[model samples]
Target: MDNPYKVLGVNENASQDEIKRAYRELVKKYHPDKYVNNPLKNLAEEKMREINEAYDYLTKNSQNSTYSNSGSSYANNNSSADYYSIRNDLNRGDVSSAERKLNSINSQDAEWFFLMGNVYARKGWYDNALNYIQKACNMNPGNREYMAALQNLQMMNNSYRRPYNMRGYSDRDSSFCDLCVSLWCADTLCNCMGGGC
Candidate 1:
């Protein structure tokens, strides 16, 4: 609503590529998925909406210097609005409501898959979540939000154990080694006491 460049944190003279990069970063930062279960989810949603609007305005009026005079609105479709509502529901931990709304949608777009992934993730179904999020990333390769979600899921899946080489010893193995050392020490002590040293 104000300066588009300011909204995106870019200068007026910034190149188109720079503007796009900034927009992508902001989108990633304030994505609904990142704000899930956070108290600041509403604020993040508002920020994301503003970022989307600014990006749309800049791209549409790139040729014209008088960007402020352009009265063009963001190209928000009904499905997109619905997706935003679903994201709000998901953020509030209402997976069932979000799932119901998502399933009612006629078009299974990238956003749909992304939202479905969020629902699955909340339900502790990581495998299904990863599958759905991967599909979303595949469908919208350039979408930073979808790509980030997929990366996060993959990282979570691999976070439990250290690599084979890095794993020096497990707790069970260490305990066994400790027991062996104690028994050997006791044997040596007993021999010394019996004058066998």
Candidate 2:
């Protein structure tokens, strides 16, 4: 992987501009946001870690080093036994074993379904990824993790958009809030005037 640092295109003495550019480009290419319902977050995290390492390496050599990016800082530890098992299998490159482990579990919580969906996304089966993430979202409607995964799958088509343009529209995407974009203001007005409940 070409000096994980070099692959991210940063140097041991790169400027803040260069580091930010490299990180942004790589993050855009492998953003968890792009793969929300994706099974490939493990890969994305790998990329993130590489980018972070490259950034850290560069910053340390420079005069402006600040804000260390560490693994524990992400805090995505909402894991379970099955999730951990799946993670191990994935790290070991045993996708089938992970899938089998997932199937062996009886209780399907949001984390379980989300990780399953992530596995599917890694396999390039976006449809199944979508299905699993949706199930996860259903199990935990308020869970940010599940919701973020489900939304990520939905954003696949627009995943390449620049960060400034990347957005998650809940009212438009959520079934309960599927209000027409054009009539949003009018709808609000009507509801305020006691016209439509």
Candidate 3:
């Protein structure tokens, strides 16, 4: 393994708080849930494992005092981790599992609605998807992720309508090309957040 300080992206002379902060950021970035269903999932898991080991080593070896991850002290704590796991299930094409997990969560924050919208979208329930995503956007007006998801849903809705309007065909007859373009745009949006799609 690399030097513990280097692994956590901190220098040897850094204070404990600096090390903790860097570790937290890296944990969020490389969490296994973030990479699940991506081609890089295994790499992300390995990186996370490395980070945990480094964090443990550094905290344990601190000369003045030893700190340990006692569950509550970690950055990607349980509640956030639960959300990440739901995202992992969704990306893995396990909408049912994701939905079940989401439903079990009591809080209905912007993230919850956004994820529910994604599940509805996956299940081809466009009306429900739009409603939930719109609610998410309303709850957190400044969130780009919610906005992008809503736009992607709207684009898909428009794509389905354009074919029926122009060719007098059913929405099911929408061109595959339009669908692909919409998906490509959505994936680009997700990529801007560091990972997804």
Candidate 4:
């Protein structure tokens, strides 16, 4: 086991409250929901494990034995490391290999699309990234993780300079509303011109 304080990102002499604060911040950053079905979910889980261990070690011998994981903590049923290793390989900068591995995956869910988008993004294939991330969003429109990935793809291209980059949206400048509205209007006009209505 690594030093509890170091694992929790706090000084050894940190007060219990200080340690708790650091742990909470890390939890917020690596929460499972934030990365649900993410290719990096495994990495986040590893981080959560470290955080859990640190909290346990510090709380077991401390006067304040009030430490608990804010959310579910299950280490037994984690996915095989083969999948995670493939994710890491993508992160290591190999799009072709990543895509090939992705092709072999049976669990093609939102995370899979998001990861494919990541590989495309790294290879400067913004168009492909956009398409894959859009598929991810379509798969899980309610999931903020997939939403964020699609947003990132939009922001990466054109820096959101022309339209989707509306003010108050965010640094990512992601928005399909404006584009969708425009396309809808165009479709409506085309329908009006056609006599096949």
Candidate 5:
């Protein structure tokens, strides 16, 4: 759609890292969470779709060009293309279709697990999402994307506290108070002995 570099607000000669940074910034700006319950939600969604398309197009073209120029046969190219399609489906809120497409693929690479985790996460299956994302992280420890996904999933799982639920202060605060009382007593004793509080 148009020039991907222009869509991402980057020059055609920009490095991959620069392109990725621009893509991420656009994604953050147009993310659905930012528009929740707002009148601009539809517009935000459209922007997000365009951003995703631009990122995908640039990434796929870059990979193809690099591989072709190097005379290298990328065996995972097809699966990678399918993964991008699945990602687009997921971005469009088509979880069932994405899952079906994922299941049709035989390979279980890091990207596969990552996409599966995304599907589960979208469905509110946090435990399953964590498991799959952790697997993806394990498979590709150096992958920033997978690591970020895992961290995000963990944060989501940990941050979901019921509004009516209250924490008990008995165990932790009691020990802390006891320690403080003992310290104060020791300080008073030292002051009496001319040590100064």
Candidate 6:
């Protein structure tokens, strides 16, 4: 709705890395769980939604070239635009369409794996999601987005206990807020194990 850059708290000419950093910070700050018992839960959800929209818009419209999983620079080609479209599909809860689009693509680049992981995640296939995301992270080790996705899936997998329902066992699932917090906590834990965050 508003200017995407302003919504993400980034300058109009900000680098992609800078925009990404701001997006992650905003996601952490406005995560829905933080306001679960607070009066601003609805506001937090709205803010998070706005943040996602802004980030998606920026990524889709960016004209700059970026390093691919193979450490080679790639231009924003048709496939790249298709990835953005797939992201929109996922955002709109159209996992099947996203998956179909992914299957149609031949290039299994870092972004491809990352989006495939997202598709699996949406399908409640956490294990597959984790594997695909981990592959993406390994391919583009320097990409914080891939790393964050990997860590989020890891934390989701580790923390899920699949609580028993009154009648029987139900599937365990994580919300976007849960996944975001899990990513932060997992990153913190990993860093602490080595030294510190």
**Please, what are the lDDT tens digits per residue for candidate 6 over residues 52-101?**
98787678545433633444212324565577678778988989999999
TM-score of each: 0.50, 0.38, 0.51, 0.40, 0.51, 0.50
lDDT of each: 0.76, 0.63, 0.75, 0.66, 0.77, 0.77
- Decoy 2 TM-score against native: 0.38
lDDT of 1 by residue, 8-61 (tens): 898767789999999999998899889899999999999998899778756754
- Candidates' RMSD to native: 12.5, 18.3, 18.7, 17.4, 13.0, 19.6
Better of 4 and 5 by TM-score: 5
Q: How close is candidate 6 to the true structure, as a TM-score?
A: 0.50
Q: Per-residue lDDT of 1-197 in model 4, one digit per residue for the tens?
A: 32566778877567879988998999999887899878999898988987886676565434321222321111111211233445556756766877887787666655567778888888888898899888877865655656777877787685645564454575443546667788999899899889646
Per-residue CA lDDT of model 3 for 165-192, tens digit only, reads 4666555556676798899998899898
Per-residue lDDT tens digits for candidate 5, residues 80-183, read: 45766787789789999999999999868777888899999999999999999999888667666778889998877776652323244556677888899999
Clashing pairs counted in every model: 0, 5, 0, 0, 0, 0
The true-structure Cα RMSD of candidate 6 reads 19.6
- Higher-ranked by TM-score: 2 or 5: 5
Instruction: Tell me the deviation in Å of residue 183 in model 4.
Output: 44
